[model samples]
Target: MCRGLDSLPITCLERAKELRALFGSFLQKSDHNLKKSEKLKLSDVKELLQWKESFDHLLSSQNGLCLFRAFLVSEFSEENIAFYLACEDYRATKASKLAPKAEKIYKEFIDSDAPREVNLDYATKAVTKENMEQPSQSCFDEAQAKIYILMEKDCYPRFLKSSMYLELTRKTRTG
Candidate 1:
């Protein structure tokens, strides 16, 4: 009985050490991610603080884009990010790959029955479908610009008002 009692403390000490190591590792990863996220440029911060600045200007910065992308994710509009990224990728497509890639982008985001279709209007969708017949670098120009405007006018303001944005701003100010 005395031996059992003596070993109990040793077992607890070992468990405590294991738990501490796990917690330390978690903190380290968390800190790393936070640092990565905190790489916002000072000019981006200035633009974000300027209420009258165009949301397009805010998104021109990598950090601003990251923050806005995170905000869109939180609002269950990750599709916006997908569409935006797809357009960006489309712009870089080579002439040889243009047709297939354009079709894929349309089927994924512009198709009426697409699983991840964005909120494009009927006219723009029709125009995008027409553009697919002759895919060019400008094929998705109209649709991408509309989506950009939508995020700017709608999502950007809400993002600024979100508690997450508020907390991030507060941290930026203090840190």
Candidate 2:
């Protein structure tokens, strides 16, 4: 079973609480005096409502992604999103830098002893390790896809039902 916020170390739990408060304050801001760019675009109810349409919609919005990342942290599953973002960044790396970048990603998120190692099937881990030998842009594609699916199918739904999400939507509606 996945560990929840209750299982997090006190420091982690405190950080999660801080993030939640930060996010809540962002949502509660009513000041219109700020410049257009200074205000979070997600303050718009329409934009926040769009998050319910699809996972891609939520991820596409910078604010939405930030909130979702915070939610993942609270769940102690932030590594999934971290790995996904790292792979996305890795794919854009210059060819000359691919090997070193790939090595860094593997060591950080794929190796058995990695500090933030992501859950993966034995076969997937072996395939990813093999792909590391060549260090192509596609080296992490399979593993990234697996993590993406896991998040979309598992985490995303729970996120939609989370109190933080519900409260934000409700506040947007009633505020």
Candidate 3:
């Protein structure tokens, strides 16, 4: 697929939409393969990340956000896990119909005190200059920051300490 907007064919973009409609359930079935479209929403990011943990560390992998944010961000700079902030810029955002649900999950994640933190780096950065001022770090700290910091580190101690190579699972059945 042509990654560049200039060289991208109209059909390819359209096909992506078609595929989302076609295999959406299957894609949604696996947290690793996010169901994204012309735009990536905060709700989508949070939901995808939640699924990632359930899918046995699949979503927690390298530049996983980059896989999506890579397209949304300029030039797809090899960083995938930078997305999933769970909250986008509040100022210019059109107010996602899904924001309430996403917000609820964000609150729950914070309240539950999940072991890892998700990052707001990508979602907040997606805000266009014309859109809004940056959200406070507190908003991110509550939403998704700490875990993202670790996800960015890429090489965690657990993966290093484990002498056994447990086969990773990609699909989420517990859901």
Candidate 4:
């Protein structure tokens, strides 16, 4: 909790936009029609708490998640909210959605010296200055699709947690 805009930097804003898109895409992909009033407190769920903690941990820098909290946490992106729900859809419904793409990417990058363990990590953080310079809708779509393909086989509990998150997304939007 760092509140207020004074602590946020311009570059962090840009990254927050990326994270917003990512979270939004996940919310957009949800198959169920949910409302913002739905209660989905994640504080009590150990696994989800871990994931959220890890996600929050990723943004330790100055105002790392301010925009995400303001934009994504408050309300859905309105336009692409549907797309964000897709993340859970394919994950819950499709069995092998995320595996193929991840396998392909891992194979592609396995021989080469990639810094991260998986392709999503490499893909999530677009490294080039050109990528960092401007936001690309295509990149977000591609990332969303690839992740969907990779996570389609997650367990039922995981999918349920994701679904709860979708409900949370809608709550965040209207509340």
Candidate 5:
């Protein structure tokens, strides 16, 4: 899991701010005709526009997933996506490795003191803890669903409205 900006050293934070400003400026200038190398293909524009159709569409596209994860990081809610992705990966784990994998996920996301703890309700956490007693592919299903819904309803809307997203879509449309 990535550390929050507040945890970064002052120099690192300054550099991050600089990068953000540079990126913002670049986006602002995107309306100007770009060199061919810098232009997004029509297909890319279509693909990016698809992300706005639904949260599932965003998650299904690799570029959309990266952009969404970055948006979540900016909002300091990246752990939600991290936990959701972890559960997706866990579901494919071999049965022989389920116990250890499940325990790792529980400790990292479900435990109260976990560094990247997700915002699960008490009941969901309890159910997940109980599920850990006999680790299986479905053990994290409930918690994952809760986090997914939370992101879809909350973060996804904000992301759609974010300057980064708006600028990209706007640029793509007119470029």
Candidate 6:
């Protein structure tokens, strides 16, 4: 039997397969990859520094979100970011999924025994649990806003002072 010209030896085929896998994983156009390819503009850094209202804009950007998450991680407050994101995603969930999703979120982040509990006040936590009796899109609103404000007032300042954020500013200015 004659093999097609496009066919290769088993060793060559194995090498090609390995290379394909490597490129597939390494070069995929993910948020991290996009940030790596396109550095933050100097104006972006300026807005982040000068505009207090622009924290929402910063969180909306992939690189900014990643940088803020890194800051949270360093401060051991990553759970706050995780809970805030979970709430954001929960807001868009389908009506039919509201109950179970709310339950899961409450158990994960609001419950006293949660593995990643957020620092909510007793009243807010109790109200959230009561809301779980009839889960809805607004069930987590209060808790979420508290977390958002906490980050805006507390974490945001610390993040700006972080060396990672400082390095980013330096790169945007010089490079």
Question: Which scores better on lDDT, 4 or 5?
Answer: 5
Q: How close is candidate 4 to the true structure, as a TM-score?
A: 0.21
TM-score of each: 0.68, 0.77, 0.25, 0.21, 0.80, 0.71
Order candidates by TM-score, high to low.
5, 2, 6, 1, 3, 4
Model 2 ranges off by over 4 Å: 1-43
All candidates in order of lDDT, best leading: 2, 5, 6, 1, 4, 3
lDDT of 5 by residue, 50-157 (tens): 989999999998667767777787898888988999999999999999999998998888899898999999999999999999999999999999999999999999
TM-score for candidate 3, please give it.
Answer: 0.25
Off by over 4 Å in 4: 1-7, 30-175
lDDT of 3 by residue, 1-175 (tens): 1234433345544543443343334434445554565225333334434533432343443323323332322333212222234443332345343344434434433323422223334444333211223323233332234454454354232332222111111212332
Q: What is the alpha-carbon lDDT of model 4 when measured against the actual structure?
A: 0.37
Best by TM-score: 5
Give lDDT: candidate 3, residue 118.
31
Which is better, 2 or 3, measured by TM-score?
A: 2
Q: Please give the CA lDDT of all the candidate structures.
A: 0.68, 0.81, 0.35, 0.37, 0.80, 0.71
Deviation in Å, model 1, residue 55 alpha carbon: 1.6
Q: Write the per-residue lDDT of candidate 6 for residues 38-81, one digit (tens) a residue.
A: 33433454544442356787687755665566557667787888
RMSD of 1: 14.8
Q: Which candidate would rank higher by lDDT, 1 or 4?
A: 1
- Per-candidate clash tally: 0, 0, 9, 24, 0, 0
Writing each residue's lDDT as its tens digit, candidate 1 over 11-119 gives: 4445434433433343344333655444344443465455326676656764456556655655767577668878999899899999999989898788977767789
